[model samples]
Target: MFQNLSERLEGALKVIKGKHKITEINVAEAVKDVRKALVEADVNYKIAKEITERIKEKALGQKILIAVEPYQLMIKIVEDELAQLMGGQKADLMLTGSPAVVLMAGLQGSGKTTFSAKLANQIKRQGRQVLLVACDVYRPAAIEQLKTLALQIGVDVYSEPENNNPVAIAQNAIQYAKANHKNVVIVDTAGRLAVDEEMMNEIEKIKKAINPCEILFVVDSMTGQDAVNTAKAFNERLDFTGVVLTKLDGDTRGGAALSIRAVVEKPIKFIGTSEKIDGIDVFHPDRMARRILNMGDVVGLVEKAQQAFDEKEAERLNKKLRQNQFDFNDFLSQIQQIKKMGNIKDLMSMVPGMSKMMKDVDIPEDAFKSTEAIIFSMTPKERENPQLLISGNGSGSRRKRIALGSGTSIQEVNALVKQFEEMRKVIKKINAMQNTGKKLGKIFGR
Candidate 1:
């Protein structure tokens, strides 16, 4: 995420904190800081300058409005500018044809194959039959990887490994999809390490051969400016209809995401986070702008939660929490839900103030592994009633066996069980306090 850019912009706005109004001098300092922050974030210098200029003009024009505080106004200004810079509106994939042929283009390792499977899963979720076509003839393993992903996601993959010509393979894949009544065909083409004439020519030929409805250029956001340059090169050759920004879960400076649209004039249709099939999110400029301002993207967060939420399971867990009966089982279940939500770093960064407050901290991706180990070590009954193990020191012979079973040391299991017991006690106390406070509030209201 753009954690660095977010922090810097927050600092820049602080320069005009508590001001009752916007002045040219104050706005100039803040805008300069914003430009500098963007530049430091690896954003194109020209794009950064152009954005700040637009922001300043908007702020100055709105100076007469006294409704919002200076800081609030500044945030609003930045949000609008950011949204405008990214794209004022989200773009949709052109899926008009009976088999909406999507052509994927990028340099090698830009995540084309993974994105095709993800998109297939997405369209399948929409109740459309999707056929993931493997046109990466150059890499023998790519088709296999795509097939595995398709199977995991419950989507069909069309591959002709014996065919060396990608254009022919793509054409055959579409024919197979049509024959099978599949309505969506995602054609994954081969990519070179860099934009080569041969690769470009092949992709362009495949595009013409398939007559695709959408040609999506996949770019690795981790590559920053290089990603933007690659998009430009690809767009010049392929004239892609949309962009898929992959590896956005990484600590990308966000330069590519910021500059690609301005450079290539294409809407970013999707963003890829982890390798998981469910890790793709449709790009939204407004939500992204909100995130960049350290404001919690409640819309995006709820969408993520809804996607991750299991209604029956959440209701069961809520009952346990309300009854002060939450245990290691519930904790483990929650961890699974969180894992399904995609990269922990990217997820946490969406929470307002979490990324900033935890800047110096490191939360490993294997965050739940230790806890999972401890929980697995517990007996079925112990997981349900953790108090016994907690009160028994979790050091008995049975406890040691449980720990060994879960592949964790006895001490770590003990710590986990102890924390769970302590948490239950804390919840009970908080509930009692809240009940008493509610009574007092009612009396005061009366």
Candidate 2:
């Protein structure tokens, strides 16, 4: 996502490298390069020109600090401008009504149905009773797809297989939600291959009927400039409250995310990070700008970690680690939590400077597959007491059985056991150091 754009912008910023001050000639060179980068990234030419002009003006007018390098100062200006270009602050979905109706709108294949289920899962996690209403009656399997996703996320779905009227189905779903005490109703509307009068009129009618609290225009971010154009047309008709940029994990040039808000005057409320239902993230413009600049998003990474880690489970694991009793069971649990946090490369990219370091490294999604398979093949007792395989000098048969069960080699099993023991020893040493510190504190009475 934005990989090419990031590299281009980095090169553009380097124009001021080794410069002592921000002068007209160097700033113009930098601005020209930046404009070219935006155009190559598929950003709208007019919007790109306007943004670069603003950046140029700010760069020339501001006073440079003696301590800050020229390149650093230019980066700061561009970051702020990028954040403002993509909406200066985060925009949250408005869910105020008793059953807030959020209508999803976009062209066909924009991921409306999937994003609806993702939104339902997100709202459900907020302690709200979310009901997903499948209103795409024209599509044959759209309703079924939504139902499947809703089931995976443990959210209720409302649909009428026999009814062809989307408006009526939406109304009925609202009534059903009211009766069933569902607090949020997400209406997934039908979309056309292209914007047509009939499709626009139908969605407008549904909007009028539902009186929705929020109307989100979901767009495929990989579509580049086309996504921005589609957004303009939809906003001209539906006046959507926010935008959902789907497929951000794809090979996106990031034109839609950077240009849609400037063209349509709307905030991007959410971004689809992956194909998983749990891959949704609230759009944060500042964090995204930092990421685009290769500055990393530590706050976003911490939030993901917090969401993935359970407090009670963490406390239990901490106790076991302190007692030197951590085993494969606990290890497997931790692995599952990390897997739930989404893609491994994405997670690691959030660390400062890791993005550049991982550019050429190919970290597969199933990097933990072998480790997990080995652990799952273990018996309950064996999992609880990993020493059974790692402690003895002659545990060849046990390792061989585990290898066969997990479809791995005995050498692979041996390697895993060796790594696990190494981790255990490190944890023990850390615990011992902490214990020594505590004892010394008690004795010194400080």
Candidate 3:
């Protein structure tokens, strides 16, 4: 997710490594690099320049505030500027009407169908009864896709295969929702390959017929600047209440996310990360800014963790983490918690600095298999405290036996032991920093 742009920005900022103060020269050099990073990431050059100019002004206006360095101040300034660029505040969907009608609009392959399902699931998580309406008449396959997702997620979908008329279908679906006590109706419509008059009229008719509470323009963030243009075209016809930026889980350059809000003057209500029903997230500006700056988004991470965290298990892990007694067993346990939360790479990016380190590295989705096997082979004592496996004691011999039992070499066993040791050290450092600092520490424990 904007990995390349992140690295480029990091490099750009490094140009003033030894500088004691912010100079027009250093700041300009850095801003140029920032603009280049945005452009390369598929941002419109004009929007890119506008953002960099604002970031530059904010950087130059930074007050030292007693002890902060220029570069550090600059990072803070840039984070804020970037946040403002991507919608200064989180915009929520207005699902106010009873049987609230939420209409989706976009170009074909822009993920309108998937996003509709995802949105339904998200609303269901809010404890609302949701009805997913497949109004995409052109593709019978689109109705199948939405139905499959709805069935997989345990949500209800309303479709009129025989009707072919989207506006009438949506009207009947709303009637069905009212009859069935469904609180929200998400109407997914057909999309053209490009913006066309026919597409606009169809969506507009649906809007008029349903008198929807909200109309969202779903655009593929992978298209970068074109995403902004697509949003504009949709907004002109639909007067969409919000925007849905999909495919951010891909290698998007961060351009669309940065420029869409500013250009369309519409709130970006949600983002779609994956095909999974749970892959959708409500847009939050501060959390996203924190993510972009490589500062871990503890708020977002905790929410995810809470959804999957078992109270008893989490408490047990918390005890070990606090005592600095986290070991290979604990590491494996944490990995399991992460895996249950869904995609490993997607969850990993929720942690700030981890993704940068993983950029060039390949983490096989099954990368943890060997670790799991080794842990399964370990005796209770060795799992509890890795010290038993550290030296040539009888326990060491037993661990060697376990390694062979697990069909892994001694080197693999040693690597696992070493990795656990390093993990404990890092966790201890983080715990100390959090406790010592107070605020950011509670985040880690959570």
Query: For model 2, which pairs clash?
Result: none
Q: Each candidate: what lDDT?
A: 0.85, 0.92, 0.83
Candidate 1: where are CA atoms >4 Å away? 64-67, 192-195, 320-325, 392-401, 407-411, 426-446
Q: In candidate 2, residue 229 scores what lDDT?
A: 86
Best by TM-score: 2
Better of 2 and 3 by TM-score: 2
* TM-score for all models, in order of appearance: 0.89, 0.96, 0.81
As a whole number from 0 to 100, the lDDT of residue 367 in candidate 1 is: 83
In terms of lDDT, which candidate is strongest? 2
Q: Which residue pairs show backbone clashes in model 1?
A: none
TM-score of 2: 0.96
Residue 193 accuracy (lDDT) in model 3: 46
Between candidates 1 and 2, the one scoring higher on TM-score is: 2
As for TM-score, the candidate ahead, 1 or 3, is: 1
lDDT of 2 at 57: 98
Question: Model 2, 351-383: lDDT tens per residue?
Answer: 867888888899998999999999989889889
Which residues of candidate 3, in runs, are more than 4 Å off?
312-335, 370-446
